[model samples]
Target chain A: MRRTRPPSPTSAGPATREGRRTWGTRTAAPTAGIATFEAGGWRLEAVGYSLRPAAHTEPPMKTRAVLSAIGPDRPGLVAKITDFLLARGGNVEDSRMAVLGGDFAVILLFSVDSAGFETIMRDRERLAAETDLALVLRRTEARAPQDEARLLWQVKAVALDHPGIVHRLSEALAQRGINIVEFESHVAPAPVSGTPVFSMEAAISVPASVRAADLRAALARIGDEECVDIDVRPDA
Target chain B: MRRTRPPSPTSAGPATREGRRTWGTRTAAPTAGIATFEAGGWRLEAVGYSLRPAAHTEPPMKTRAVLSAIGPDRPGLVAKITDFLLARGGNVEDSRMAVLGGDFAVILLFSVDSAGFETIMRDRERLAAETDLALVLRRTEARAPQDEARLLWQVKAVALDHPGIVHRLSEALAQRGINIVEFESHVAPAPVSGTPVFSMEAAISVPASVRAADLRAALARIGDEECVDIDVRPDA
Candidate 1:
């Protein structure tokens, strides 16, 4: 669920007290040829009637990137990558790594100044060759604010190991214009029988127009056809 | 969200077709004096009615542990810790790490055989001493399956930077017997005013009896009192 918060004291009280909550729509004449207005949802008034040259400093405009690396498991693999990033002034913001089979796979979100990012782009090939990693890098931005009408939901499914489960399920959501935000899956043995069981979990965003009951019924139908146990509910 | 799935073909079909879904409830006499029953939600039958010595192989009864380490940032830190774990037959299951200020902080989930776990416990002190790290380790287990009626929800809040935001918010939740599963927060400059805005997001599990409307109203009151914008939604 996405909804704008009701006005809070720190943000809205002062303007409301002035009997005008609108920005840049004032009908009254400016007291000093300077109009009071809001920018980026923050109230701003020309500090002091006399304006001086603004501070020369600019806010840090950091650029972010997503990096995925998969390589043979070996000592110093993580060190190599992290060391390189540190040397380039890149800061890791978030990361997840795991060992699967005999290989190590990692995904990292990092930010760097623009020039440092350029350097990373130039040197990525050399580092990949040295580390023997299959590397994928893509520039990314912070997620935009969510639309207030979108609904978030979670879905979980379990079944005997089978193929096309993700494809079939995702296709239905895609047809309905739903977006999958995060998904994870694993295969494990049934505690007693040692038979492989597949399980999946995903977070999705449903448009405001979709009916939850209709979506649940659709998923129940798919559960019957695919022999899967599917559960869908609003995501916390 | 945690409801046990309705009967599916592969797991439930066989038993249902036999006209008895209840395990070990048959009244008829067994032809071979063997009682068939479900174990761990699986169907199993004695093979060939033979009682020969069963295979001696044991399923891997792996144990899990959580490790948290923080140390001065330097080259090869990850390598040093991971190399030690690999040498001890430990497998990295999940990991998250980042550099906060000038210190590298990491939390890892790993699994090992019981003996190997004991070995790690014994050597952890030496590792911490040698690496100049603050290390904490605790045994963990896979989360038990969720109860069917528990409600999973997500909460997010943004407010002018202030003390006690988390404390006050969580206190309300704790009073309601809600459990926090995951939480993260950060402070960043407001886009225009450069005011430090504190933002938080959390995933929580509410008891079955908690009404969603009541929870929302409670959060709304907190938002008003704390001068924060709070959004609560059923999580997907």
Candidate 2:
């Protein structure tokens, strides 16, 4: 539920009375001339005190790219990868790199405007050839404004540790015309017994026709059939 | 904005039909002997059959703990930390450990039961005291539950990357009586210019009285005062 309103500048009462200002009025006055008005309460002595809105400047468009690299873990791996992007007209946006099972994997989201990206992607093929690393590149489109109506259901499943659990559940959701916006899965040892346990967290969008209760029931059924425990709840 | 609905299972055609079958409903009725039925197009004959509703049993409650560690970057850190959990009556649920700017930082969500948690929490202090590591314990009650609201608003600030951005924004939300369910923030390289950028993703609950527009306006003001760019949108 509803929690009590905390102390804030916008909240009513004494808090609002202390040097408070309206949103528009905060920026309306020139930053340099604010001291004069502060001396006298709301008295304007100057005539040309007109406020001009700041110029609207849109950020430059940049190319979006996805890159993946796999190789033996080594020192300066990230530095070398970043240097590659810097050599081109590219900038790394988001990246998740890890060394799992003795193999290094790197997934990067980057953007660039320089035309040299094509050449870099072609040249980096040699890294894979020489160092036993694999690299792939794909241009990505700008992410559209995400529609909120679809991101409603949050699903979690727990079961005995096993492979292909993620694939099965994801395939089931896809079959039901659901889209997963975010997902995380892991296998952890049981706290007391030391048995391995698998758990997954997924944020999904369900069609209006698919009632939440029905989806939960169906997931529960699937969990039972697969010997797991599933919890589906709305994700704000 | 309502979109067109995809086709349903029944609407797809007869191939998607689902039919229920009962035991002993088919074949020559046991002439005072055994009964038989066909399930999944397979012949099933039995002297007796029982039907039961599928139910999933909850796993035994496990004691959960959270650990924090910070140290100089080194190899085998994960193995050592995980081996510690394994040795104790604990399991690592989820963890985000990284080496940023030559310093390794780890935040792990883990669990242990009534078996040997006390000893682990006690012994873990030695690790923190002896090394640059820092460990903390968080029980299950300290963990926030997944919010059940469907709409999520993600607020991000980007300008010159600086500290205290998260603290200020979180304090603002806390002051406004908003509940933050989940949050993540990082300093990212700029997408186009290679400049430093600060980004934050917060899943928050907006009460009915507090419109999204108002929240955005408030955040925009904060961004202006702090010389940062703020983007507030639903977390689809």
Give interface RMSD, per candidate: 14.6, 16.0
- C-alpha positional error of residue A90 in candidate 1 after TM-score superposition, expressed in Å: 1.7
**Which ranges of candidate 2 are over 4 A from the true structure?**
A1-60, A126-131, A143-148, B1-236
Look at candidate 1 and tell me the lDDT of residue B175. Answer: 66
Q: Tens digits of per-residue lDDT for model 1 on A1-236?
A: 01122223343322444353443322333577554443333333432323122246343467777666665544345556766776776755555454433444555556677887889989999889987876766566555555648888999998875544555676677667676554445556789888767677777778887899988988898899989999999987
Judged by lDDT, which candidate is best?
Answer: 1
The residue ranges of model 1 lying beyond 4 angstroms of the native Cα positions read A1-54, A142-148, B1-236
Candidate that scores best on TM-score: 1
For each predicted model, how many residue pairs clash, with residues at least 3 apart or on different chains? 11, 3
A-chain TM-score, model 2: 0.64
lDDT of 2 at B163: 34
lDDT score for residue B234 of model 2: 76
DockQ winner? 1
* B1-236 per-residue lDDT for model 2 (tens digits): 01112223222112212323343235675556655554333434445342222235233356655555554433344545655666665655554444433334454455666565777877787666554454444443332333444355666666665434544565566555565544444556676877667665655655555677778888888888878788888777
